[model samples]
Target: MNKPLVVMLGGSGFVGRHLAPRLVAAGYRVRVPSRNRNMARDVGCVPGVELVNCNVHDPAELRRVLEGASVAINLVGILNESGHGGAGFNRAHVELTRNLIGACKEAGVGRLLQMSALNAGRGTSHYLRTRGEAEQLVRQSGLAYTIFQPSVIFGRGDGLFGRFALLLRFAPVLPLARASARFAPVYVGDVADAFLAAMSRKDTVGQVIELYGDEVLTLKQIVEYTARCMGLKRLIVPLPDALARIQALVFDFVPGKPFSSDNYRSLKLDSVGGVDGLHRLGIAKTPIDAVVPKLLGEAGRQTLLDRNRRVR
Candidate 1:
């Protein structure tokens, strides 16, 4: 018997890297559509994963990927847009979701798992606003869907900690905006478990699972934690609102947009979750201290090995 085909949009990302292998292990044939196939090559090389170059934002292109697929998962989200406008956020989050829904309907795909953010729709930031907008569409799309609103997700290669670790390594003093902004960092593995749990249980079809970790830490605490894990002594400077706005405005034009005004607006609301979605899903939370240090250690070893090879 042939395995069920699961189509993943934006499966080259951090979470997708972990989730795709889990799906394959669960006896599903995973198809990942990326704009650049080379970006998803790690996934493509994995057994039972079909990585194809296709523009998921395009309806026709998305439809082609969704054909005969049993499920569709959208993990595409951007923290900042190319420029200082809402258009990029809308296109990436809302419009892309609309296209994905239409394509699913056209292909008769029955299930959809959407990755959303905590405090979505509650903030003025384009990132959360469009995330909320996309969630609304998924709710009304009339398809069997499960929406995941996750707090800061942490794991190997996660954007939250990994990015911070890299930045903290260079700077002795870190200027942070909204340092008091709080978050219950969720483990990537628990998040994947929640999705898988939701996938198997049809009762979760109309449910919104807010995934979060066990610890509630502030922005300052998170950065400090990362620095400590790396065995680095760093000074964390928490910027007040006045300074933060200026920082956001200045960083807006920075290449790669390390931070922006939209991100600043989003930080106004705490990223903490109300309900224990992981607990509700019957999955235990993985604490940051246990996992982060180990990953950092391994990463440090790898870095040293690369540096040694370069010396030759």
Candidate 2:
């Protein structure tokens, strides 16, 4: 019997780096699409996975990719827009989703696993608004689908812990906005497990799973924990709402959009979840202590090794 094919959109990202192999190991042939396959060569290198350079925004391309696939997984999401409006967010989230659904229908793909953010649709930021819009599209798509709304996801090369480790290492004092904004940072491995479970279980179809961890941590606490895990002593400055807005506004224009005004607005609502989806799915939630410290330790070792090599 031929193995089922699974198409993974945005499968070159950090989450994809962790998810692709699992699907492959699950006895499915995985196809990963990327705008630049060379940059995403890691995914291509995985056994039982195929990586293609394609623009997912284009409907024709999406249809082409969706062909002969039993399941389609969309991990495509952007925290910040290219411009200072909802247009970019809409295109990335809603429009692409709409196109992906239509393509799925046309291609007769039966299953979709969508990656969404927590508190989607209830925030002032374009990020959450677009997330909600995309979720709505998915709900109405009439496909066998499972939507995952995760709080922040943390792991190696993840935007949360990995990002803060980089920023925290350079500064003696870190100024943080929405310092009280809380989250249950879910482990990437757990998120992957959720996806695998949903994929295998028919009962999860059309259900929305809220994925989060055990500990409810404030933004400041997360940063502080990152510093401690890395064995560093740093001062953390929590900014009031007014100055936080200023910081977001300034950072919005930063080259890579490390921060944004819209982000601060999204932070107004805590990222903690009411229901523990990982628990509901029978997966143990990984606490920050179990994962973050070990990851930071490895990163510290890597940095030292690199420095020693350079010195030679």
Candidate 3:
């Protein structure tokens, strides 16, 4: 018997890094399409996973990748854009979704698992608006679909705690923006499990599942917890909304865009969820304390070892 094939768009991203391995473990052959195959080499290393060089945005290329695949998981999203306008967000979220849906139809792929964020479609931020738009597109696409809306996700290699840990290592005084913005950081593993569960269950089709953790913490609290985990004594100062906007503006021009005005706008809405999608899927949510301390402690040790080697 041949294993079912699953094409995972954005399978090299943080969440995809976790989910792709699980998909392979579940007896599915996973195919990940990336614009640059070299950048996605890690995902390609998975035993049953295939990584192909392809631009998913191009309609013909997307259809070619989806050909003969039983399931398509769209995890493609961008937090920050290259320019000031929302065009980047629209293209990544809404336009790509539109193209994916069309390609899925043409290629005979029936199921789509869309990765969305909490509070999608509620705020004026381009990120949320575009996510909502993509969700609507999925709903009306005439294909069997399940949408997973997760609050800020955290785990090994996560952007939340991991990012703050890096910033705290060097900066003694961190000027934090949206310090009061609240989030129930969901575990990436739980989110991946939710996707897996939904894949086998017919009832999950047409359902929009909201995934989040138990603890509701403000951004400032989350950063403080990260600092404590790393045993670093860093002063985290919360910038007022005005200062936060200025900071976003300044970083907008920065090379990597560590922060931007779009991010600030998105943070205005709290990321806490009302319904527990993990519970619906019968998956226990992993708490922050269960994972963060160990992950950060190990990371700190690795950093120390690297520094000692450099000194020697």
Highest lDDT: give the candidate number.
3
lDDT score for residue 97 of model 3: 99
RMSD to the true structure for each prediction, in A, is 2.2, 1.9, 1.5
lDDT against the true structure, per candidate, is 0.89, 0.91, 0.93
TM-score of each model, paired residue for residue: 0.95, 0.96, 0.96
lDDT tens digits by residue: candidate 1, 1-312: 989999988788888888888999999999999988877888888899998889887899999989999999999998888977799999999999999999999999989999999998887899999999999999999999999999999998888888888887668899999999999998888888788788888788988999988789999999888877777778999999999999999999899988899989999999889988888888988888879999776655665576688899
Q: 260-279 in candidate 2: lDDT tens per residue?
A: 98889999999999877888
Stretches of candidate 3 exceeding 4 Å from the true structure:
302-312
For model 2, the run of ten residues with the poorest summed lDDT: 298-307
Per-residue lDDT of model 3, residues 1-312, tens digit only: 999999999999988988999999999999999999888988989999999989999999999999989999999999989998899999999999999999999999999999999988988899999999999999999999999899999998888999988888778899999999999999899989999989999999999999999999999999999988988788989999999999999999999898999999999999999987888889988888999999999877877787788899
Error of 2 at 157 (Å): 0.3
